[model samples]
Target: MIQMIKKLLVIFLALAITSCKTQKATESKDSSQPNVLVFYVDDLRAELGCYGSETAITPNIDKLASDGVMFNKAYTQQAICAPSRMSTLTGLRPETLGVYSIFTPLRKVHKDVVSMPQLFNENGYKTVSIGKVYHHSSDDKKEWSVYYGKEANTYNDPKNIAIIEQLKKEGKNPKGPAFDSADVSDEAYKDGRAAKYAIETLEKLKDDKFLMFVGLSKPHLPFNAPKKYWDLYDKSKFKIPSRKKPEGVYRLSLTKWGELKGYHGIPKEGDLDDDLTRDLIHGYHASVSYIDAQIGKVMQTLEDLDLRKNTMIVFMSDHGYKIGEYGAWCKHSNMEIDTRVPLIISRETNYKKRKAGKTSDALVENVDIFSTLVDVCDLKFAPVSDGKSLIPVIDNPQQKWDEAAYSVYARGKKIMGVTTTDGNWRYTEWRNSNTHEILGAELYEHKNSLLSYENVSGKGNYKSVEQRMKKLLEIKFPSNGEPFLQNDK
Candidate 1:
């Protein structure tokens, strides 16, 4: 009878051990999954105070960077608004999607391409978008479970028009000024309305596992902001970007200027008086500050609702804008100022247990955002995505990562190409795939020439370097069954 009792006790102990292991595994899985918030901005660059810009006073964004991981060298797949947004959401290159211009519909390219929001929604998350998440006017309602606001704001809406008319009667033009100024307050802009809506959404969706995309449309164009934000900066202290335009560089035609507005050329020497430049700087700084304030509002709401501990926040721009840099006013160039953007990721408490407040120097692209979200959520995805999951680097910043980012732009009927940091050198080459003609080639030794004014492409000393880069380009993107170049004229 005693021997029988001993065997029964052993069996009971074995069952208890197995039960404990199963409970721990279930807890681990629960802790690993986290809610996601993507705060996407338009036409923003790495010009924040945290990124070493002395002029712009972005306290909130700087705080976000301080509290999270700030990427030093993040890039967009393309510099344009629509294509960049498309690449970011789909994890596919613009070339791969055949979406090179704003005129093309994304659905036309691939009706069945899985977007980031769709992926999240399929995995039991309520995915919602507030304001300009995809290209304005592009039919993308199918991607989100709930989409709020118009393509660019409701300016065209009759109600918004009526509101603007009332403000006009009170001696205020909804459109602030000819140039952007930072002297204005956030209350005067549409982004403020968008921010308020996002906060309300967060408050409403408190109990659901959600993927919230808050898109802020500010500091993009018409550079208009309230007068108080402009007052924050001393106009006398503002200085324009130091890079000069290359002589004999091709200029866009009149038709192109009409499409993109006055962003191609520098004001002829002394054309922009000190006051104008300062005002422009003030407007941009104010717009950034305004956006920063809106972001803070959303963050505070999440914290107040006790969602911060389980939510992962990502802040990034669709692409960098020139803001009068390199003698250019807007983005379209393969230059660093136009391509390099700020990217920050704040890990959730569970993910933070393994990777929190850690900065990774690994080169990342906008396309990677799709895979990163999937991996972070512990969801299974198809085997073929153009981007790699950044979870490994998030856990171990010192891990070796070997990949280079690429950006493409179509001018007329031909596409221009750019490849990111090959070691210390950044190379840009433009070729017409149909005509096989090399339009332009620029090679910058980023270690020595960060501003990229000194092009060493023609210099004999960099011949081997240029050759190697050209070879890499050819290997990565073979001629598309056509000639190497075309007549873009």
Candidate 2:
């Protein structure tokens, strides 16, 4: 009996040792996978030095583009923050998710949808979020393994802070100065703190597989940055754009610049004084340079830790922002300036195929980012996404791509405008939601004009182009007048 007991004990010990080895091997396999680092910026227009903006000083972003492939014609699914971000992270369109407002949380509508971060987390990668990845803090809490979300304020000046406090005491939302050039350290601003968080997180996760999202809130409203960044540009060099609305544009296509009007010094009505306009533009340029410096710090940390070679890095914005274009100060329309964004994707493995430092004019959308990352990382998810993988275009920028990029804007629940652009012509049709009857249509040519200054729908020469764009929109998104749900997937 004693001999038999000894033999069974030996067999049990052997099985335990084998189990330990298997677990170690699995961990090793996961850590061998490439890491993902996303630099998500807010309200950044494609007007950087990399995008041929001669006046903007953005050496960090320019360097990144030189090391990666820059998409010249990237468009967002929507031109607002919450919906645009939701669409990109979910790999679904705004209509599919039924999320058009920031108040609507992600899981509120699509409880079962697998977000991009969640996919990586479930696949054995540690996911981290620093700063403002989502529009709301409570959104997709389960998606991140670690979340450091300390938001910064709009103004750092003592007087502006006092004003904001008084407004809060009066039970009203506070509105501070339109722009602030505080003589403070870089860490005194939002993007600076976010960069520090990202760098620290990188140090902690150097030995493991991680999907790190570093969000930078800059070039947004209340343009505030360190005074050092403010000194990077000449105030006289910035030009205020045209204040006129496009001829024949639907009246509903524009807003009264209400977002900027609420600031402390802005007039409630009428055009901004030319001096104030130049100063606002200067503040914006300073904010961009400030964020660019923050990005540089994070990128330096990645290199110091030897994470760059094994990491897939993507630099993108939530959506484009309109700066004094057509008298619009914010993004809330289907115009090209609002929908177009900057996208740069870089991976060391891309160097094997000579894919680095190139420009792709292929029309791409923000939704395509989700699938592209998945494909590049060799990750797999069960559900098919709405976005097409841009790996093909990345491999060969000259390759033929989809006909156009699409965007939609809802003017309340009653009217919706759907637009399509192919870099040559942009076409839109506003329709009644229930009946899908066309209420208004717009067509703008991009062949010669920098800005779409007029609507030429049904014009003598552009009729065929308008019809083609309309058919493309109809085929891709049929007007069923129903909330598109994932169950329809």
Candidate 3:
């Protein structure tokens, strides 16, 4: 008995010693995991300096694109904000989310889904959402370790507040025009406050592996920007787009200008005049510059905390903005200008293949973000996705990819569906949910006109092209009006 006891005691001590060494090694590996920072912007399209914009003051954004892999053919799954955000976060399409508008929450419709940040949380990374990561905070409360959300009133000047109050007292709403260029400081805006929060969080999370989402709400509506950004542009340098209705396009494809009509100076029912149109364009450019500066601040903080080297950064907009394109004021259509967005992904020095300063024109979708992050971070999740991983394209930007991208826009069950970049063309079909009949159809040759200002689906010359595009859509989506990922296909 004494001999047996002595042998057991010796084995126990050896096992304990091995366990301590293993624990220490595991802790060291966990601490060295790369941080993730996603800078989500509102209503920013593919109009940055790196994307060949002549008037956009986006030096910092341009620099980010230059240092990262910029996706030239990135498209949002939906043009609407709430649905688009839900799709991107959950790695699901709008149809799968069952949400078509900002009024609906994803949690109500899809309870079993796991969001992008939530996946980081599960992986032992401290997840932090600084501002507007989701359309609503309640969309996914399980995701963030910390969240900072505030009302979007960036124009906090005392004088502007008084003017707004006076207007409210006079029974007049305070939505003064579709744009506001106040001669105030940048910090006076809500986005500036959000940036401050992001900077502070970066400092606190510098020592740990963290996933931070900083969303800036600008260039969305009211085009509100500090006067400094506005002064950067000369009105004479702006050119107003053609406001005429596109030839051969259905009226169903046009927005009724619901958002723009709520503002003060816009016409009740007509296209904006040249001068008003110029200011709106000018205001959008200023807002873009204004938000770009805020992004610069957050990025600088990342560098100050020395987190840049080990951080995997993703900068993207939720959806594309119309900004007077096609005489459209907002994103409520299936147009390429509305569905396409700007997406840039930057990996740290230690990442494989290091496609770090490259650009990929491969067709990609917003929902692919979830899977690509998982691929880069090596995350494993049980949930399936409609989005495919973009790791192949990241490893080789010249790799052949899916020939098309998909997007959905609906005004209550009346769906406008599309499969774009099919041989440099976009094909759209509008269907009535109650009746399985096709209500409308559109086809645009993007190579002929980068902006599909003219619709050619009705033309006899493009009849076969239309058929081919329609068949592509049918193969990807089911005819039963509900959307599900057919992975085997």
Winning candidate number (lDDT): 2
The TM-score-based order of candidates, best leading, equals 2, 3, 1
| C-alpha-based local distance difference test score of model 1 | 0.69
Ranking of predictions according to lDDT: 2, 3, 1
Candidate 3 to truth, TM: 0.89
How high is the lDDT of residue 373 in model 3? 79
Check candidate 3 and list the clashing pairs: 154-189, 154-190
Residue range 332-374, candidate 2, lDDT tens digits: 8888888889999887553465477899989999999888877
**Tens digit per residue, CA lDDT, model 3, 1-489:** 999999999999999987775665456348567888898998898899988888898998888887789998899988878888988888988766667778777777666788887777766678887767788768746668988864565554466566677778899988655666677777777787889898888888788888888888888887888889999999887988877677888768878868888876678887878898888889899999999999899888888888888898899999888777777787877887888899998887577677767898798999998888777777644268889888889778888998788887775655545445563788887776544467778888776434866788878888898888877787766456554322110
lDDT of each: 0.69, 0.83, 0.79
Clash statistics: count for each candidate: 24, 0, 2
